[model samples]
Target: MPEKVIIRSIISPHQRESFTQFIPLSPDMTREIGRTVKEIFDSLGGAALLKSSRDVYVKPNGIDAKAYCYTRPEVVRAVIEYWQSAGARQVYLMENSTQANYTRVVFEVNGYRDICRDTGAIPLYLDEEKTIGFEFTGRKSIYDGDPRGYDRSHCEMPVTVTEKLIRRRDENLYVNVPKLKTHSMAGVTLGIKNQWGFPVHTSRGHDHNYNLPYKLTDVLSLLRPDVTLIEGIEGTVYGHYPVTALADRCVKPFRVLIGSLNVAAADLAGAKILGLDRADVAHLDQAIKRNLTGGVTGLDDIELEGDFSTLENIDILGDKPSSGKYPADLFDFFPWDVKVLKGKELACREGCVNNPLTLLQVLFHDHNGRGGWTLVMGKGFDPDEIDEIQGRVLVAGHCAIEEVAERLVKRLGKKKVYLSGECNDLAATAEAMFHLMKVNPVSFLPRRRGAAVLAFLMARLHGSKSRVPNPLSHLIKMV
Candidate 1:
């Protein structure tokens, strides 16, 4: 039988202290987290598992640590101090954020760099270092594809190891330290979300997977760590960006530190603490479906320390569970369903709007030898730019280009103007309706479909026209 999952909670009356002083964290707050880690780990099993560890990797959830969206430095520092006492030879805290600015600056802004230096733990950027790929084996369920039969995928892909934190033949313990926050895509990001930092810089595109919460959890299901610690002191209730925090003053300040042996259990518990619905999160559901947590129901064995009732009072000011009917049965997701794509490819008329799934899909496929597509953007009634190109083009979605269909049929003389993205169904339905009527249908452009539409348009303009089958054709054609 698998070892029993363990979770320990540390509740301090002081945790509820407010940050009225305009600092990111307080000394009292830091000490509280350290005490929590020490208490929980000590009670669950013991510190002996980590006592002789020579190297430690404190993976902090950077989520681009712009401001309120990431794991606070103080929380990580507190953990570092605890690890030092545990006899860890070297402790390294690391993350790779997505902001265009320098990682060092971003780290400093969030006070992570200073915390690392002060605590004698080295700060590293996963993106900048030279990565060595290691083979890993893991499994995932194909609920959307084959039912009644479970499936597995070996995570044996080459993974880049952190060289700076490497120790000689000594048992390595990972302390997953992530900030508590609501995710628009994953539902909630905690320990599992922090593991995305382990891959090489090239694999960066996997994050765009719309079903990232699940995909990420799948990845972690194979490489789960020894423990997880979450910094829930002051988390962004809004999506995972600092700019959004200021523009949208929605964040929850929960003074609780969570520790768990099971990553999913920790996230599920963390979600409740943040007052989020675990079922609503795509990744948590996926992870559970794939048996990533041993079983979500198995969480009954873990201990809960703080007031479970307090979770009810957490006011979610930003990202919250979608009101749409969440899939109760993980197997309910079907093969043809868009959600099965891992990440979705949403088409828009212009490239302005960013669709996390489609963006991630393109990046993953491109990096992993799937296919490379061009980005297109344009408006209706515009002269066809494909005329200048020698290859074929895919109009990912319809835009109000003056008789674009007519133009594709007229000037360009191409029949394969692939329509994908948001309004493809509606546009295709409208086209079918017009085909039934035997006349050109009015161009129906949906809002937020601009990104797909623009990709199509630009592909036409910049000679992105190549006669390749649309990735979403099997799904879209059925519609």
Candidate 2:
């Protein structure tokens, strides 16, 4: 029989605290927090998992830390210090930031560098590190209906993993500390969802089979977190990143969830804490279908030991069950399912949008109702309507390209209509829209502009080797 999948929780005494107070976390708080973690860790037999381990790998959820979207460095520091005191040979803090941006930027931008220095830990940017690949047998379901998750091509092709991780022995443990947040694609991001960071991001391109849930299932089966720690000190409601505490959609749910030996179970408890159904999340549902929880049954099956009542009905990003999803009001202008195309049909999936709305949302943030950009996605377009007064029409998918690209471009002129050649690719499409809006997307990022400026000045003044120079800017404002 599989070992029992046990999970527990602790209501942070400071769940009522504000996010802005930057006072140093006191030693008393640290010790108590460490005690809380160690209690849970010991219960999970995490120390035995660490015995004679080649290295201690801490995978904390973040591109960089902001208010509620990342694991608290204090928590990570506590875990590392505990293990170090327990005679860990070496400890390494590792992450691969989203968008393939600079990992060091997050380390510096989020005070992780300081955490590393204080804790005597080293950092690893998985994106820049050496890697190796292994074949994934797609016998597992890789898609919605497809019982087999990946295709023969995916199975035949070697799935690459970081060399540092691939080379480690099975007993060398992986500690997964993920932030608590609702995801747009996966419903809620906790333990299982957080594992997405482990894979090389480029594998997500059109070729590698776009089945995120199944892909994660295969990866988790091979190497999932030995212990899952859900960071709820602070969290976001709808989506991750480019979010502000109050302005975007962030919330503080002063709670921490710990699970022993099962990532899915930990996520199950975390999902309920976020007031989300286990069925609503694709990956969670898929895990059930695959029976990948190491014999742990459903959400009810997991043994819960904590102040469960405290987690009920916490206000998230949206409201009700999805306090974590973005507010629908942001789409009042281009309401989802309202046909903007001439005659194209758009299939609506749960927790997904058709058009590339990233640029629109960002534009709205900077210029809410004033921006003159109108997006018409899907197929079927009336030439007369398309020719009428307009700023730019964003052809969102391949269907639009097939149906309207030529006529629309001929009438509106090449500069007027932007075609996102691929279907439903938000990043590429949003970038195209950014060009139409006369704004560089990079500058919109918090500290990227400052960094670019520094890199430029460095090259100009010091004959720098690289294209751009570095800037001395404050990314970790709170830190």
The number of the candidate with the highest lDDT is 2
| Candidate 2 local lDDT, 1-479, one digit each (tens) | 33333333443355324544323455565566787777777777755667456477888886543445467777888778867876678888877654424455556556676788888888765555444555554344336455424432242111223343454436466788887776655567788877666655444322222355666666666566767777665555555543342332345444454555678778776676566766667677777777887766565566655544333453432355434423222223332322344344542221113235533554444433224555665455666776673666666655557877787778777766766543344444545545544444444344445554443343345421111111211121110
Q: Largest TM-score belongs to which candidate? A: 2
Q: Kindly report which residue stretches of model 1 are placed more than 4 angstroms away from their true locations once superposed.
A: 1-22, 99-102, 133-170, 211-214, 242-248, 298-301, 307-479
Question: What are the per-residue Cα lDDT tens digits for candidate 1 across 315-376?
Answer: 43334446322112111111121121110223221121223222323223222212222223
User: Whole-model Cα lDDT per candidate?
Assistant: 0.48, 0.55
**Weakest 10 consecutive residues, lDDT, candidate 2?**
470-479
Per-candidate TM vs. native?
0.58, 0.74
